[model samples]
Target: MCNLIGHALQQALTRRGFIAGSAVGASLIAPMMCSAVAGDDELDTRIEIAQSSGDTASSRTRLLLLGTAGGPTWWPNSDQCGISSAVAVGDAYYLVDCGEGVGKRLQQALLPANSRVMSANLRALFLTHLHSDHTVDYPNLLLFGLFTGLDRPASPLKVFGPGRRGQVAPVFSLPGSSSPTAPIISPDNPTPGTKDMTGYIYQAFATDLNDRMRDNGKRSLEALVEVHDIDIPQIAGFKSPNETPAPPMEPFRVFEDDRVRVSAILVAHAPVWPAFAYRFDSEDGSIVFSGDTARSENLIKLAKGADILVHEVIVTRWIHGLFPAPRSVAEEGLMQHLLGAHTPVEEVGGIAEAAGVKKLVLSHIVPGNATREQLSPAGKGFSGELVIGRDLMQIGTGQAAAPARKG
Candidate 1:
C-alpha cells in the first residue's frame, strides 16, 4: 500500500515488477475504482495542515506528505500523486522516494517557503527499494533539478539506496505446472543498485548534461549529487536476495549531520532484496518511513519509539477484490504475491502499536481512491493518533522550535 518510473531498455527492466502509471494502468480497474485519494474525510485528531506557508519555516521538524498514492498504476479519477514524502527540519528537507509527480508536488508543497527554487534546500534522498514507482521520478530530479536550484546548495545532495540484488528472483509457477522461463534483462549488470542507477542516468543523459555544463556553464552532475549503495549487513540467516530478502538485523547508521541522524534496516519487500526502512532522528523528535514492507520485524525494530511513523497501508479488501473468487491458479498466485509484499490496513495499527510510536500516518496507500471508512480500522489497535494521509498535507513532529528571544 505504500506509494508509488519510465522507459527505454533499462526502463523496460525497471518496469518488470508490477507497474503502471500509463493510460492502460489508469484503467486497470476502472469499474470498481472511482474518486480521489484524499480519502473521504476532513481533518481530525493530531492531523496538522499548514494554514499559512510560514508555519513550516521553523527550526523544529515537520513531515510533509508530498504524494501519497502508492503503486505504479495511475488510478482513474484520482489526483493523488505517486508516493513521496519529506522530513523538513527548518529550511532544509530530506526526501524519501521519488514517485510520480514528485517534482511538481515539491514545487507545490515546498517551493513557496523555499525561495521557489528546486533543490535549494533538498538535503538528501533515501530510496526504500528499486521499484519503478519509488524511483520513476529519480531521473527527472537529477536531469531537471540541475536546471533549477540543484547546485545552489552548499553541498551535494547525498543520496542513499539499496545495493544490487545479486541473484534474480525465482519465477512463479502453479501447482503441477512447470515454472515459466524467466528472461534476464541486462544480464551483464542485471541488478544495479543506487550508485549504478545514478551512473547510468548520467550516461543516458550525457548529451543533455554535457549541454548544460558546456553550453550554460553548469556544474557537472557528480558535483550536484553524491550517490551511494547501502550495503546489506551479512546476518547469519541471510543467504541471497532470492533466498532471504530481509533477515533479522539491527538498524545501522547510514548518514548524519548536525540536523538529523539517519539509520536504516532491511525490510521485507520480497524479491527486492535489501529493501530498507529509514529513521531520521533530530533534536525535534524521530520520524520513520516504513518504506514499502509487509510487517517485518526489522522494520518494527527500526521504528521503535519513533515520534511519527509514516507507514504504508494497502486496503486488503481492495486487493482481494482485484482477483475475485473462482480465480485461476495463476490469478490466485498473483493475489498472494500482492498480499505478501504489503501491510494491510487492519495490520498496520498493530505494527505501529508494537513500535510504540506516538502517531501513525498512512501513506503509499493502494487503490489511491480508497475511502476513509475502509481506512479507519487502522486506528483500532493503535493507541497513537491515525492520519489518513492526503497529498500535500503537513504534520509537524515534536514541538515547534521556539522563536529566538530578543535581548
Candidate 2:
C-alpha cells in the first residue's frame, strides 16, 4: 500500500520537478497525476470520509489544525485539507500558512451560525515560505475573503513573509542526466518574495478587484491588506554559495500585539532559502511552528520549552519506495532533496524531545493517506505527547475556563 501510494504521488512529483526546477505551473497537473494512479475507488472514498477525527477544547489560547497534507498534489485517497493552522487567543486568532482549502476550513473552524465572514476575528497572517503548497490559496484569501469580511477589519489585515532572494535559484544538475539549461520564468524578477507576490496577485485579479470596488462599493484590496517582507537579520556564518543559505542564528522578532509576541528563526530548507520556524508566546503559553525543514537545531532553539511544537513530517519509507532501487542519477538527486528538506517521521520525535516541548503535533504530512501507525514513528524517542494532526482538530495551549454551574 505504501509503495503504491508513493508511486502514485511520484507521478505528481517528477524526478526533475518542484525541488530542482522553477516550474510552479507543474503543480497544476497534480490532481490529474493523482487520479491516474489512484487506487480502489471504494477504499479511497471510505478513508476520505473518515479522516476528520478531532475536536476542540475551551481555553484562552488554542491551536487549531485547519489542514494537514503536504506537497503540491491533491492526494486521491485522503480527506485532509492543505497545510494551514491557527492560534486563537481569547476572541481574536492569528493564522499561519494559507494553503488550498483554507477558506472552507476556516469557516468550519471559526465561523458562527448565521455568519458568512471568517475574517472578522482573524488578527494577522504569517507565511513560512513561498512554496506553492503553502501559498496556493493566498490570492483566494484576499479576493474571496473580502466578501467574507476580510476587508472589514478595523485595521488592514497584516501579512508577512520572506523577502526576495537576491538571485534566481540555479537549476539542478546530476552526473549523467539533463543539462541545467532550462529557460527561466519571469526572468526579469524570477524570484519575488511575499510583498511582490501579493502585488502580482492583486494585479492578476485587478478586473475583479476594480469591479467590486466600483460596482459594489467594496473596500479597495489595497486598503484592506498590509503586506510586509520579513527582513532576515545578519547571521555570522551564513553565505549563499551557488545555493540557498541558512546559518546559525537567534530568533528575531517578526510581529507582536497585545495577544502574542512572534519571533522567527531560519531553518534548513535549502533551494528554498529564507524558510522560517515561528514561535508565538502569549500569556497562556508558547507555540512554535517548524515551517518545513529537516532536523534543524535552529528550530530546536526557537521551540525550546514551548507548550506545543507543530512540525512537518515526511515518510522515509515512502521516499524509499517512491524511488525504487536501480534509480537514475537524476532520480537520486531529487530523492536527496526531498529527504534533506523534510523531516523524516523517525527523527521528528527527537526534534521535539530536544526542544523540550510539552507536545509534538505533526502536520504537513506527505502522502496524505498515511495511517496513524505509519506516522507513529514520530513518538519513538520523545517523552512528550505525540499527536497525529487531523483537519479541524483543536488542542488547548492555555488554561481552560471552568465550566459554568448547570443549576
Candidate 3:
C-alpha cells in the first residue's frame, strides 16, 4: 500500500500543467446566491471601519482585498491569477490589478461600483502589468461599472499603470476604429476564431451610454470611464542594473498627500519586463505588494521593513523533481519556463526575511504538487509569519499572526 501511494505521488509530480490560485473554501462552498446583492445594492453604503492614522496626526489609511487569483491553474471554484489590492488614503480606493472575474469579486466583497474603498470618497485603478491574468477583465470593469451606475459621478475612473499606455488604444466608442478581438474556442466559427470581446462588450453598453447622453441632453454619459496609460519601460538587464537612475522608470505613487504616501519599484519577471512591487506608507504603518515576480533584489529593496509583503511564488524543487522523467520535451520546456519565471517557496521566505517585513503573505501561488502539506517544506527557509493564501481570505495589517499549521 505504501508503494502504491508512492506511485500516485510520482504521477502527480510528473503531470505538466499550468496552475493558478482560486477560491477553495467559502467562495466555492458558499452558495452562489446573491442575497446581499439583492438589498439596497449600494456599494459605498456598506459597513464602515476605523482606519489607522498616519503622519501629521491628521489622516488615516486602509486597504481592502478584492480579487485573489494565483496558482498555475484557475480553480473552478475561483477566478484566474488576478488580485486587486485597494488602498484607502483618507477617502479613495486605488485598485492594484484587475484580473478575470474582478468585477464579480468586487461585488461580492461589496465594494460598490463607484464607492471609494474607504469611507473617505475617491476612486482610482492601477495595473501592475499587462499579462492576460492581470488585465483580462480590463473591459469588464468599465462595462459593468457603467451598467451598475457606479461610473455616474463627475470623477472619471482614474487609471495608472506601467508601459504602452493606450499604445494599442482600447476599443473606443468612436467609429472607424479597429475593434479588439479574442480567440474563440468553439467549432461553429471554425477558422481559429478571433471574436471581438471588446466590441461585443461595447455593443452591450452602446445603447445605455448613448441613450443616457440623449436623455441628459449632453455629449455623453454623466461619468465616463477614463483610461490613463502609464508607460513602463521594456528594458533588458533591469534585474541587475549597473547604472543609476535606471532609465527614468516612474514608480507608482497614488498620492503626495504626506498623510499617506504610496510608492512602487520595478522587479524582474522576464520576458515580461518592468514588473512592479508597490509600497503603501502611512504614519502608523506601511504595506508592500510584490505584483508578480521571481526572486530579485529590487523587490527586497522595495519591501525593506514594510509591514506586509504580499508576494507570488512557484514551487521549484517540486517542479524539477516532477519533470525530469519520461514526457514530451516540449511540455517539459514550457514547464521549465514557468518555473524559471516565478519565485520558489524558499526564495519567497528569503525575500521576506531580507526585507524585514513585519509579516509575510505568500500569494500568486503555483503549487507544483497538490495539497498544502507538500508546500510546508518551504517554511523551513522562511522563519517569519507565512500565509498560504486562499481566495477572499481577509488579512489585517501587521501585527504578527502565526501561519496556519500544515495539513
Index of the highest-lDDT prediction: 2
RMSD of each: 9.0, 9.5, 14.0
User: Residue 19 CA error for candidate 2 (Å)?
Assistant: 40
Compose the digit string of candidate 2's lDDT tens values, residues 149-185.
7877467899989888867766667656556676788
- Which candidate model has the greater lDDT, 2 or 3? 2
lDDT of each: 0.77, 0.78, 0.51
lDDT of 1: 0.77
lDDT of 1 by residue, 210-238 (tens): 99898998889887798999876568887
How accurate locally is residue 210 in candidate 3, as Cα lDDT from 0 to 100?
Answer: 75
Per-residue error for 280 in candidate 1, Å, reads 0.5
Candidate 2 C-alpha RMSD relative to the actual structure: 9.5
After best superposition, candidate 2 residue 60: deviation in angstroms? 0.7
Candidate 2 residue 395 C-alpha distance from true site, Å: 0.5
